[model samples]
Target: MKPWILGLTGGIGSGKTAVAQAFIDRGVHTVDADHAARWVVEPGRPALTKIVEHFGAEILQADGTLDRAALRQRIFAVPEERRWLEALLHPLIGQEIASVLAHAESPYAILVSPLLIESGQHRLTQRVLVVDAPEALQIERTMARDSANEEQVRAIVKAQADREERLRHAHDVLSNDRDLAWLDREVERLHTFYLSLRGGQA
Candidate 1:
């Protein structure tokens, strides 16, 4: 049988990675969409070749790797460019994610993605689990973690689905507005819940 997939998502700096790490610690098989995205565009990959063809070789670093920061800036600044890139990469990334999940040996698996809802990845899962935090906190955390200024972080936040919309669509909500200890407890609780769910399905 196909393993149950929990679609995990959050806006930038919403502590999604922390929650995913907690699940990983518990031996949950996890497939990260971001990792799949990178994998598709790795050097010598067809996706990278197509990207270079469309965006030019300058988008590559000296080591011949994609200049991710430059690509990010370009996509954010130009809607057409972003659409073109997404059109090229999204299918490849989706195929890679599917292949990874198919090999999952755990009773269930986690598909962690920042754009789970936006990219419609939630459709691939049995449930949607959102890691939520206040917008101000998200901005602050992103600024510190990404070394991005307030304006840039705010723009990213704005580009994403609003907090209310994400929560509205969630089957589970993990509030990340508190300390790590609190977050740990919540993760533990959810882990138990997921295990119980898997048992029931089995």
Candidate 2:
């Protein structure tokens, strides 16, 4: 049988990665949509071939790898191009996510994604878990980690589903405004809760 799946999501700069790592520490298997998205467009993949055909070879690096930064600039600046890329890549990423999630041997598996709600990836899960922090906190964290300016971080936050929207869909919410100790404790509590829910439907 397919394992119980939790959709863990949050906006950029939120503590999704930290919470995901905490779950991993507890032996939970996680399928990250961001990783799946990257995998689908790797060199030698059919998606890469199609992307090259559409965007031209200039989209690739000197080493023949996809030039992700260039492509990111293009798509974010052009909505049509973004839609086209999403149309092509989303299904492939979904397939990869499903394949990995099905094989999870833990009591339950987590599908960790920033776009879990926006991309419809939440449909794959039995419940949704949202990692939340304040907008200012998100922007600050992102700017520090990515070395991005405040404007850039704010733009990213704006592009993602708003805090209210994410919270509206959450079956569980992990507030990440505190330190790692609080996060670990919350994760431990949730881990035990999820384990109890194993074999039960959402």
Q: In candidate 1, list every pair of residues with a backbone clash.
A: none
The runs of at least 3 residues in candidate 2 whose Cα sits more than 4 Å from the true structure, single-residue gaps closed, are 199-202
lDDT of each structure? 0.90, 0.92
lDDT of 2 by residue, 1-202 (tens): 6679999999998989999999999999999998999999999999999999999999999999999999999898999999999999999999999999999999899999999999999888889999999899999999999999999999889989988989999999998999999999999999988888855353
Candidate 1 lDDT, tens digit per residue, 16-129? 999999999989899999999999999989999988998899999999999999999999899999999989888888899989999998778999999998888877788889
Stretches of candidate 1 exceeding 4 Å from the true structure: 198-202
lDDT of 1: 0.90
Query: What value does the lDDT take at residue 200 in candidate 1?
Result: 26
lDDT of 1 at 138: 95
Alpha carbon lDDT of residue 91, candidate 2?
93
Each model's backbone clash number = 0, 0
- All candidates: TM-score: 0.89, 0.94
lDDT score at residue 56, model 2, on the 0-100 scale: 92
